[model samples]
Every structure is written in structure tokens, then in C-alpha cells.
Target chain A: MREVILNSYREAIRDRVLLVVLAFGVAMIFSSLIIGPLTLGEEIRLAKDIGLGSILFFGLLIILFIGNRVLYRELNEKTCYLILTRPITRFQFIAGKAIGLFLTILVTSLILGIIFISYISLLTGSLQITAFLAVIGVIFQLTMLVGIVILAATFLNPFLGSLFTIFVYIFGQMIPRAILLAKFYKHLAIARILSIFHYIFPDLTYLDFRELLIYNNPIPLERILFGFSYAICYSLVMVLVAGLIFERKDL
Target chain B: MLATFLFQRSIPPIYHHSEPLAFLPSGPMVEVTTAPLGPISPEIIWLAAIQYYGEEKISGGKFEFLTQVFDVLTRIDPLFDHAYQFGSIVIADEGRSPEQAIRILKRGLVKNPSSWIPPFYIGFVFYIHLRDFAKAGKYFELATRRSGAPEYVYRLAAFAYKKVRLRKGSILIWSKIYQNTDNQTLKEAALRNIRCLILEEYLEYLNKGLQRFEREKGRKPEHISELIPEYIDSIPTEPFGGAFKYDSSRDSFISTTYLQIEKIIAYLNNKLHVFKQKFGYYPERLDELVAKGVIDFIPPHPLGRIYNYRFGRVIR
Candidate 1:
């Protein structure tokens, strides 16, 4: 399991697409310095928002491009066939690949986060601890996304898998709004269906702390604790489900 | 190079431009489309709006889509206070649409209920752009009630209240500021406002009494005291450490400080008239009055202005 995780991590790190995404993320953060001062004294806030936004956007891109292909590449190249014949079980393979992709995303996002935090401190002449917490929120959101990608990769091709993951993420973020809309129109049946969907999917909005960074507000300790537990639990369920499907497949 | 230059010149010189907000979907459609991106959509739009405004300012072009851009931005990010504030300023000043600016600010106020800044900006738009002091006062007063409002909000409320002739309301706000502020300058300014408000009421009362005296007696009163029993109950004391005095020539009462200055001007003109009558021509300058022994001495202007003889008139 350890060797498979390391090998997958090394492959993802060596991907040229990862470097391009990271470069675009850094460019976006640097461009905020020019765009932020155009606002009426909201320079620091604009920078913080754009910085965190770049982290979330580029992290999602990494997941879509790399995490979406992590499994399909192994199967298409017959690498999984070679590995599955060894001592590693199918669940270990699935879990190890998910963890490796997640680590790549985590490291890439951390690099972007460090640059953003450093840039913000240079602009404000002081460290922003809230910026750090907001970056963590982005990481948690990407963790759930990587899980969804892995789950989709089990049955769908790379293109379809990416599309599915994107739809699920968008729908997951809109779960609260969907529930509210359902209740607003007084559609009890729709509300019940949305409630079930809400229970099944990860709510990406829960892990979005950009507002806290934008308004310089503090996140409560309980929310951080809840977000941590929810991301871990959701990712574990996704990986286990994908493992089950892969275990039963004839490939 | 020559071909490129000629081609560029051949192209018609662009005389007009609109902001890129024309590409935006309607509010609900935009919300549905950008729902995937969440807050990033609004942030991107806000940056675009700022750049458009800056370009308009540089080029001195009318903001054709300023209201539209801001409307779209605030619609997506309802709690974006800076967008409301800066957008309203550009719309009001550059777009020439104060009403639309106020509309955006009011929406911000509703969405950001806990924020005092939106209401403060609403008051500013009403006061500066619309010149509707009553509405300005109402918004400024609302702002003062919101948490985290600055002390200056009270001052603007008082000023706006005064413009609408709500003297009591104005004085009430000024008194609050005076009582609460620890800054010496602000405290002094509040005190001055209170004194001026009282002075305004007193002057209005005295002027009304004088008018009544003139109507009833068919002559202006020789003194303000004469109007006490007939017109006013009593003469009010001056607030600026000066007594009120009657100016029979103008048929009005003025504070002593102003009367002193008016007397100096009147004396200089009187001397000029006498010189014209005696010499059949006016002196070329005020100094000639003293040169020709028309008066014993020239009194200095009380307002630190040099009196000049201009075209047979004593002017300062």
C-alpha cells in the first residue's frame, strides 16, 4: 500500500499539467495586487478574496485533470492488472491511489496558499492567521472532490468522470439552496427528496471559509472540528464505495 | 510599419464605448449559470467593474453600463459593501444616475443589515448627489443606530437635519455628539453647531416681531425692545457673545459685531458723499479723504479689508 501510494504520488507530481495549473494559480494571485487597489479602499480584502479563490479554483482544476485520470490510467496501461496480482488487495489499491492524489492536491494547494499568505502579509505588513484557516477550508473542499473523482473514475471514462464530478460538486454546493427553494415553493415532496440528496452528498459550502477571509471574520472552533470530521468521513465512504465496485469488476 | 499605420488610420476613429457588462445574463440566469463557481463569480465581476470605472475616469467617458454592472455585481454578492459604496459613487458621478445609485445602496442596506456602511453611503448619495437633505438625514439617522457606526455619522445627520429646517432634531443630534465625543475638535464643533442653531431660531423670532411692528405701527421700530410687549414676549440673548442692535436705515436688527462693520462702511460712504458734494467730483481713492481733511481720520475696516473708492462709491 505504501509503495503504491508513493508511486502514484510521484507520477502525479511529475505530470506537466500540474505545473501549468500551479503557474496559473500563482499568476492569478499576483494579478490581484493590480486589481485590488482599483477598489475603493478594499485592497486588502480583494487580495484575500482573490487569493483564496485562486486556491479553490486551481485545486478543483487539479482534481479534474489529475484525480479524474488516476485510476483510468492504471487500468488503460494494465498497471493495475500487474499490481493486483501482487499482495495488494483491491481496496488497498483504491485507497492508496485516492490518498496519493489527495496528497498531490494538498501539496500543490499548500504551495499556492503559502504564496498567497506571504503576498497578503507583504501588502498588509502583518501576518493574516485567518488567511491560513481559509486555505485549510479550500484543502478540505478539495479532499471531498478527490473522493468524488475517484468514485466516478471506477465506472465512467475520464471525460465523463470529470463531468460527473463537476456536476456533483456544483449540486452539492447548491444543496442548501435547493432545499430552501423547495421549501419556498412549499413542495414538500421535493423538499424531502432534496433532504435525502443533502444527506448523501458532501456540502461543499460547509468547507468554504472564503467569506471569513473576505470579511476578516473568525471561524468558530466547532465549525472547524465539524468540517474536519465531515471531510474525512465523506472521503472514506467514497473510497470504500469505489473499492467495492472495483473489487467486483471483471477487469 | 507603413502599411499597419495606414490601416490603423483607415479604420474609423472610435467615438464611443460601453462597459463589457453587456455580455452578462439576466440576474436569475446569471445566478443559475454561475452557481457552480459560487463567490468567485461575484469577485471576478467586481474586479471588472473597478477596472471599467478606472478606465472611464482616465478616458473621461460616460459610464454607459455603470448601473448595470453594479446591479449585476450586488445581485450576486448582496453583502458586498464596497461594491455598493464605490459603485454608487461611480454611477452617481460618472453615470449621472443618482436615483439608481441610491437604489443599489438601499439594496445593500437591506442585504447587509448588520453593516452601517451601506446606510452611511445611502445618506451620502442623498446628501451630496440628490441634495435631498430630509432623506439624507433619515438615512444618516438610521446609520447612527446601526452597530459599528462612526461618530461622524451623527455629525452628518445633524447637518442634514439642519438643512431641512428640523432645528430641534438637529440640536438633539448635536447634543448627543457633544456629550459622547472625547475628541476636543469634534466637541467644539458640536458646541458651535448648537449655538448656531439657537441663534437661527432667535433671529427668525426677532425678524418676525419686527415685521409685525412695521405692519401694525406703519413704521419700523427704533429699537428691538419696543417689539417686546407688542410683537415678541422678550428679546432673546445673542449666542455669539454679542448684543443685537437696531439698524434703522435697513429697518432690521443685526448683531453688534455686524453693526460695527456696517457702521464703518456707512461712515466711509457718508464722507465720500460729502466730498463729492463739496468738490463736485469724488476722490480718486479713500486716502484722499484724509489728505483733503474731509475726515479727521480713516477708521480701519473691521473685517480687515482695505476700503477703496471705486467709481464714486465706497466699496470694500
Candidate 2:
């Protein structure tokens, strides 16, 4: 499992795709320093905004496109056949892949984060913890998203898997609001259906800490713990489901 | 985020959306603009707004896009207290959007209940620009109740009431400013406004009575007392513990202090006549008159005691 994790992480990093994403993220973050001064009195706020926004956006892009392909590459390259022949169970394989994906997103977000934080620290003359907190939330959110993608990949092709995963992530965040909106439009039937969907969906909004960071609102420890716990539990369940499905599949 | 941009609610093209925030920017414009970047959206928009404001003067003294600019900014970061306050000031003073400024500040007050400056600026918008004294007083009073409100806010509240002739309200505010302020200049100014308000109230009272007396008796009344139990119930007492005097020649009410000045002038005139009779040519100065023994002494004027006296003409 450790070798699987390291090889997968190294393989993903060696690709040109991640490099371009990192370059874009870096360029965007630095561009904010120039864009921020054009803004009137809120230069710092704008700069911080650009740094966090670019990191969140590009990091998520990596998860959506590159992240969905993690297990697919193993299956497509026919490496799963050799791995399955070994003593390792299907659960261990999926778990290793999940960890590898986690490592990949961690490295991606960290590079982008370092570049962003360095630029911002130079601007403010001090390190801002808000961006770090927001990045932490983004990392957890992407991890959970990757877990959902892995579960989808077990049942569908990589393209359909990624598409469905994006839908699930976005719609999950909107489920609670959709229920409220259904009620507001006075459709009791739709509202009830949406409430059912709300209970089943993994709310991505739970991990959205950008507003809290930008506004400098108090972030209680319990809230962070709850969000992190939610991501862990949800992703763990996805990995278990994916392992169950992959176990039944004929290589 | 891209999805938010694709199907983003478009701002209604119409300038008038006279609903809840009808005068406010359309909901579509605000939501779409601020939805992308989280809280940073407001900071960015606020900066953009500042640049927009600074780029050009309000053409023809009419500002446009004011509501959209601030609405988007505040909607992006509702806790941006300075943006709302500063936006309102800009809209009112520079943008010539007094109505929009009032609207924005009121919204700011709702979001930031603890902020005193919003209501203070709101009061000024109504008081200084709109000329809606009643609304001005209401907002000023609200401002004064909050923490960190300035000493002059209370004065403004009272002054607003004073303008619509709410004597009790004016007096209350004036008395508050007079007693509350430690600054001598501010206290003196407040006292002056109060005294002038009081004098105005007195003059108004006498004018009404005089008009009524003239209508009834078919002539201007010789004394304000003539109106007692007829046109007026009773005479009004001077606020300074002095009396009001009726100037028959001018057909106006004057302060009784003028009477003392008049008496001194009369005495001086008699001495000048005596001096002119004794001397073939009139003395150019009062001290010269004294030196020539025209009179025993120069009678001091009541208002300007021992003041300079010079004649442009020789008294025949």
C-alpha cells in the first residue's frame, strides 16, 4: 500500500498536467499584486482574495480532472491485474489509491498555497492564518470529492465518472438550499423530494471557509473539527463502497 | 463557480425596479457580480468603485451606477462598514445621489447596528441636502443614542426640530449641547443658536399679535399690551430677562436694550447742540468739545462706553 501510494503520487506529479495547473495558480496569485493596487482602498483584501481564489480554483480543477483518473489509470494500464494477484485485498487497493490521491491534492494545494502565502506575506509583512484555514477546508473538500469520484469510477468510465462527480459535488452543496427554494416556490412535492436528496448528499458548502477567512470571522475549533470529521467520514464511506464494487468486478 | 457565471442572473436593464430596493441595483447584477470570489468580491468591487468614483466627476452633476456599485460591494461583504459609510458620503456629496446615499446608509445601519457613523451621515443627508428636517432630526437622534457619536450630532437633532419651529425639541437639544459639551466655543455656538431661536420665537409671537391688533382696531396698536385678552392671551417674557420694546416709528418690535442706547444718544445730541451754539465752527471731535468747555463732560454711549465720536458734518 505504501509503494502504491508513492508510485501513484510520483507518477501524477511527473505529468505535464499538474505542472501547468501549478504555473497557472502561481501566475494568477502574483497577478493579484498588480490587480490589487488598481483597486482603491482595499488593496490587501483584493490581494488576499486573488491568492485564496486562485488556490481554491486550480486545486479543485486538479481534483476534478486529474483526481478522477487515479484508479482508472491503474485499471487501464492493466497494473491492477498484477496487484490483485498479490495478497492485497480490493479494500487495500482502493485505500492506497485514496491515500495517493490525498497526497497528490496535498502537494498540489501546498505548492499553490506556498506561492500565494509568500506573495501575501510580502504585502502584509506578516503571515495570515485565514488563508491557511481556508486552504485546509479546500483540501478536505477535494479529498471527499475524490472519494466520491473513485466510487463513481468503480461503476462508470472515467469521463462519465468525472462528470457525475462534478454534478454530485455541486448539487450536494445546493440540496439544502434546493429544498428551501422548492418550498419558497410553493411546490410541496418537490420540496419533499429535495429534502430526501438533502439527507443523502454530501454538502460541499460545509467546507467553504472562504467567507469566514475574508471577513475575519471567528472560526471556532469545534466547527473546524466537525467539518474535518464530516469530510473524513464521507470519504471513508466512499472508499468502502468503491472497494465493495471493485471486488465484484472481473479484471 | 463557472456554473454560477454561465447561468448568472442578469441585471434587469431597467433603471427603475421600484420594489423593496427598487432604487437599488437589480438583484441579478449584484448576485452575479459578487457570487464568484466569496468575501474578496466585495473588497475588489469596493476598490473598483473607488476607481470609478475617482475617474470622472459626476457629469451634469448626475451620478449613475451608484446603487449597483455599492450594492454589489456590500452584497459581497456586508460587514464592510467603511464601504457603506464612505459610499454614502460619496454618493451624497460627490455623486449627487442624496436619495441613493440615504438608501445605502439605511441598509448599512441595518447590517451594522452598532455603528454610529451610518446614522450620523444619514441624518446629515436629510438635514443638509434633502432639507427634510423631520427625518434629519429622527436620524440624528438615532445617531446620538449610539456609542461614539459626536457632540454636534445632538445640536443637529435640535436644530432640525428648531427649523420646523418645534420649540420644545429645539430647546431640549440646545440645552443638551450647552450642558454636555466641555468645549467653550462649541458651547457658545450652541447657546447663540438657542438664543437666536428663542428671539425668533418671540418676534414671531409679537408679529402675529401686532397683525391681529391692526386688523381689529383699524390701526396699529400703540402697545403690545393692547392685544392682551383679545389677540394674545399674555405678553411673552424675554428669554434674557429683559423686555421687548415696540418701535412705533419703524412699526417693529425691538429689544429693550436698544432703548438704553437711544437715551444715551439723545443726551449726546443735546450736548452737541450746546457746543455748536457756543462755538462758531463745530468741534471735529468730542474730546475737542470737552477741551473748549462746550459741556462739563462727554456723555458715554451706553453700548460703546466712552467710545470715539466724530462728526462728518459741522453742526449748524
Candidate 3:
């Protein structure tokens, strides 16, 4: 399991897609400084806005595109067959791949987040503490997304799995509103469907610290702890489901 | 074989299906809200600008387009505070109609009462643009009362009251700041400045009325009351409840008792102007004017109570 995890981490680091995603995130943050003058109020606001937005957008893109393709690539290359021929169980293989992808996402997000914060601070002359925490929230959301993508890739082709994961990410952010709309509809079918989605998808809205950043409000420590716990539980559920599916698949 | 088939059937449907789950519902269901409308297009924003400005080129079609744009933006994201901020400022300042801006801001505040930006703009329009200090003060007061209003709101409200000569109102507002703020130096400085300013304005009006009387009559009045019929609508009362003093020997009015440093400054400025006009140059010292019986005594600075009457050459 340890060897598989190490190999997967090395393979993800060498992936061209990960490098492109990281570069795109850095470029977007740089572009924010150019756009800063056009916005009203202080220049710091526009820079912080772009920096926080870029981190979330690029992190999700990496999780969706690269994460969805990672497991499928191993299967298509018959690497999974070679690995399963070894003494390792399929469950261990799936866990190692998921852990490796999660670690890649974690490191990539942290590097981009630090660059974004430093650049914004340089431009604005004040560090946005809320923006720093918001980037962490985005990273947590992306980690949960990685789990969902791994689960989807276990049964679906890479393209379909990626599309579905993207759909889940968008809808996950709108879950509270969706639930409210469902209540207004007074239809059990719609409510049940929305409820199932609420349970299955990570509540990405919980990770939204954009208001705190914009208003310069301090995020409560308790709320951060709750959000961290939710991400862990949600990611564990997704990985467990993915492991069960991979365990039954024929090599 | 039968047992294997049964076990496979009992397994979750996810394990049985090699294909990806296609759970997306089919058909164009009737959406109650519709796709949160699109962003207000740039053309619509241009049209709105034109319509609001009453440009000759903007037709009825363009006016309708602008309304649609505002409607779409508000509907799609009501919490977009910039739309309210920029939109209301354009309406009030450019459109020259505070009523229109108030309507737009009221709608926005109904949706988001907790937002401070809209109220700030509203108060700014009333105070700065319209010169409606009372209404401006009310809006600013309301803004400061809100949960998330900035510290600047309180400061601005105090300023707006001062603009319209509402000294008591301004003092009341600043007193709130003095009570609430932790900065002892700032609070003390602000209180002192407010007291000085209120007294200064009062003395200024009296001095101007007195000067106007002297200009029109070609001689100084026997009493300040004699000028009230022609030069002033009413006598200017001192801010801190003291009568302005007049000295017959020096032929000058003084406000030293009430600690009106600003009044004394204005008196010196007027004396300097009169001296330059008479002698074709300013006095070498304020005492030269005292010898000429133009002033009874030079008033001291209110803050430091220091005499400051040395006349310097006018730079201009």
C-alpha cells in the first residue's frame, strides 16, 4: 500500500496536466493586479477578489480534470492489471491512488494559495487574513471533490466522470438554495432527489468565505473546525464507496 | 452458479453496472426561477446610462433595454452591492434626481438592509450634491445605526450637520463618538475643534454684517444694534452664550470673553485688508493698528490663548 501510494504521488507530480493547472492559477492571480485599478474602492479589494477566486477555480479544475483522468489512465494502460497481479488487494490499490491524488491536490493548492496571498499583499500593502482562510476553505472543498471524482472514475469513463463531478461541484454550492426551492415546490419527488444530492455531494457552500473576505469579517474558529470535520467525513464516505466498487471489479 | 448469480443480484446496483450512472433527469422541466437571468449586458448598461442622462440619441427601445438590464442584474444577484452603489450615484449626481436614486436604493435596501454602501451613497448625495443637510444627516444617522456600518459614517454624519450650521446637532453626534471611541487624544481634539468651529462661524457672520454696515454707511455705527436694521437680518449670537464686546476707545469689536480665536483671526484679516487699502501697504506690527485706535486689543488664540497679530506681507 505504501509503495503504491508513493508511486501514485510520483506519477501525479510528473503529470503535464497538473503543471498546466498550477501555471494557470498563478497567471490568473497575476492578472488581478492589472484589473485592480478598474475597480472602485481600494486597490487591495480587487486583488484579494481575484486571488481568492483564482485559487478556488483552478483548484477545482485540477481536481476535476486530473483527478477524473488519473484512475482511468491506469486502467487504459493495463497498469491496474499489472498492479493487481501483485500481492496487493484492489481495495489497497484504490486507497493508495485516492491518497496520492489528495496529497497532490493539497500541495498544489497550498503552493498556489501562498503565491496568491503574497502577490495580493505586495500590491495592497496589507495582508487579507480572511482571504488566506478562504483559500484554505477552497482547498478543503477541492479535497472533497477529489474523493467524488475518484468514486465517479471507478465506474464511469473519464470524460463522463469529469462532467458529473463538475456538475456536483456547481450544485453542491447551491444545495441550501436547492433545498429551499424544493420545500417551496411541495413535491416529494423533487424533495427526495434534492435530499439525496444533499447527502451525496459535499456541501461546498460551507467552504464559502468570500463574504468574510469582502466585508473583512473575522471567521469564527468553531466554524472552521466544523467545516474541516465536514470535509473529512464527506471525503471518507466517497473514498469508502469508491473502494467498495473497485473491490468488486474484475481485473 | 445459481449462488453466484444471487450474490451478484444482492450487491448494490453500482457494482453491477459497468457504465456510468446517468441520473440527470430528462425533459425541460418548468423552472420556477429560470436560469438566474444572465449578467446585465454592456449594451444594456450603456442604454441605462443614456436613458438616465436623457441623451438625445437614446430612443424608447434603448430606455426599455436599460430597465431590463437593471431588472436582470438585481434579480440575478440582489446582493451585488456595487450595482446599488454605482447605480444610485449615477442617478443622483448625473441624473440630478435624488428621488430616483432613493427609489433604486430603497429597493436594494429592502433586499439587503444590512448593507452599508447604499445608505452611504444616499447620504452623500443628500449632503454633498443636493445640499439637503437635514436629509443627509438623517440618512447618515441611519447608516451609522446599521449593524455593519463603517466608522466613517459617524464622522460624516457629524460633518453633514456642521455644513448646514446645525451646531447643536453636529455636537450631539460628535459627542457619541467622544463617548464610544477609546482614543482619548482623538476624542479630545475633535471636541475642541467642534467648539472652536461653532464659535468661529457665529463670530464670522457678526463681523461680516458689521463690515457691510461700515461699507454702506461710510462710517462705523454708534452701536452694533444700529446696523441690525440694514446690514443683518438679526444680530449674530455668540456660540457659547456671551455677547460680542465693543470698545469705543479702539473703535473695534472683540469676542475675547467667549474664547473666539477664529473671530479674532477674521477681525485681524479684515483690519489688514483695510490698512493695506488706506496706507497702500500692511502694518509693520499689530500695535501700529492699536496706536491708530483701529482695534481695542488683539484677541488671543482660543486654544493656546497666545497673542498673534504680527502682520506679514501678503504672498499673493
Q: Which one is best on lDDT?
A: 1
Which portions of model 3 show Cα errors greater than 4 Å? A180-193, B1-83, B95-100, B107-115, B123-138, B147-316
- For candidate 2, the per-residue lDDT at B220 reads 76
Q: Give chain B TM-scores in order.
A: 0.47, 0.42, 0.36
lDDT measured at residue A23 in model 3 versus the true structure, 0 to 100: 93
- CA shift of B264, model 2, Å: 57
DockQ of each: 0.17, 0.13, 0.04
Clashes of each: 0, 0, 0
lDDT value, candidate 2, whole model = 0.70
TM accuracy, model 3: 0.58
Better of 2 and 3 by lDDT: 2
| Candidate 1 share of real interface contacts | 0.33
What is the Cα-based lDDT of residue B171 in candidate 1?
A: 67
Q: For model 2, how does the per-residue alpha-carbon lDDT over B4-103 read when each residue is reduced to its tens digit?
A: 7666656443422112223434543454333434435565566667655543231111235656677667654666766766677567655567998887
Which tens-of-lDDT digit does each residue in A62-142 have in candidate 2? 876777788788889998889878888888888888788788889888888877777777888988778788888878877
Error of 3 at B197 (Å): 23
How accurate locally, in lDDT, is each candidate? 0.79, 0.70, 0.65
Better of 2 and 3 by TM-score: 2
Q: Please list the residue runs of candidate 2 whose C-alpha ends up more than 4 Å from where it truly belongs after superposition.
A: A172-194, B1-25, B28-64, B90-97, B112-121, B133-316
Docking level for model 3: incorrect
- On the 0 to 100 scale, the lDDT of residue B113 in model 3 is 74
TM-scores, in order shown?
A: 0.68, 0.61, 0.58
Query: How well is each residue in A118-207 modelled by candidate 3, as lDDT tens digits?
Result: 886776688767667888888888889888998999999988998889777767765556676677667668788888878876787677
